[model samples]
Target: MELQVLVLRPIFFFFFFVFLTILQQSSSARVLTITKPDRHDYAASARWLVSQNSWGVLSTLSVDHKGAPFGNVVSFSDGLPEKGNGIPYFYLTTLDPTARNALKDQRASLAISESPLGTCTRDPMNPTCSKLTLTGKLLILEGGSEEAEVAKKALFTKHPEMMDWPKDHDFRFFKLEIIDIFLINWYGGAKPITVDEYLHAKSIKLASFL
Candidate 1:
């Protein structure tokens, strides 16, 4: 009786509680769910924003706009839902100014926000609504290469419409070779997440920030 009551019973309850806690945490990390990470966790916050958002503003050195900064709304993918690879891939048409400008000059940036995920209680511009800007060379992927195949899978899995886009429209695959990162998820201004930190991030965790 003493063994059962003093050791077994308490141990059983402790394991049960731990199991329940893990289940709840796992449920919160679902693909479509956008529970923001801790504000101080800059890398996780940036990765979370990139993984959750399907579209963003792609800024480039505009050929049409006479060298001014040009921003175009575009759809992109980092990877499959919860298992993103942390690099934004775009399916673009050369007929559009974005791809056209990128070809002329590779310097570019993609900005994404958490507001589209529908988890932010504050205004879209509110500090709590995380945002990330990835700056790098926007390079076009070679057709039929291995990385291009990965790009195709990542894009098609996220944006099904791309598979049906007009094949003759010069739509092609592109990726942002991120060299800089600027993120903001809380009140203290942009968080310092490095390009290496963002790309190698396997998951959104505070420890992954390093």
Candidate 2:
């Protein structure tokens, strides 16, 4: 009886571990990081990605390519972390083609990803990793305007280097007037999130606590 007990205990433990692992995988096919909000909460997920990420691909209609899509890596801010208004703001200079192209054609898009958060275990392109693309007119903020003031504070607080950039670089504050928001946060297809949903989505910290 004693020999049987010892042999069965090891086997029991092994099977138990396998059961737990299979159960875990089944429950969370796409694991949400400890810092990340639940994927089902699409609005919160989208807002979290935008607020946490400092950089993304800003896509614009190319001037040199006669309307080919041009995507450039750029730094941006959505207010101060948790205090964000959900609208992405950029500091750009006309010396760069992104700002130059936006001037000619207001149509533009900013694509951000959750991969940068260092939470995703899968490939960056994997749907479970999550990605957001905000499409809208990229409008330049008027200097000395109220919105511009907010933008300046938002940008400088997040990226201090912008403040010390050469004054003659023609650097200006630009914002994505998001007309559409596309978000993929799970195994399912794109979530049914709108610009309003994303803008109004509360901070992940608040949402999780509530």
Per-residue C-alpha lDDT of model 1 across residues 87-170, encoded as one tens digit per residue? 999999999999999999999999998887878889989988878889999999999998898899999988898999998999
Candidate 1 residue pairs that clash: none
What's the CA error at residue 26 for candidate 2, in Å?
31
In model 2, which residue pairs have backbone atoms overlapping below 3 Å? none
Q: What TM-score against the true fold does each predicted structure earn?
A: 0.80, 0.80
Q: Each model's C-alpha lDDT?
A: 0.85, 0.87
- Could you tally the backbone clashes for each prediction? 0, 0
Per-residue alpha-carbon lDDT of candidate 2 for residues 1-210, written as tens digits (9 for 90 to 100): 999999999999999999999998765543232367788888888888877788999999999999999999999998865578988999999999999999999999999998877788999999999999999999999999999988998899878989999999999999999998899988878899877878777645532211
Query: Number of clashes in model 2?
Result: 0
lDDT of 1: 0.85
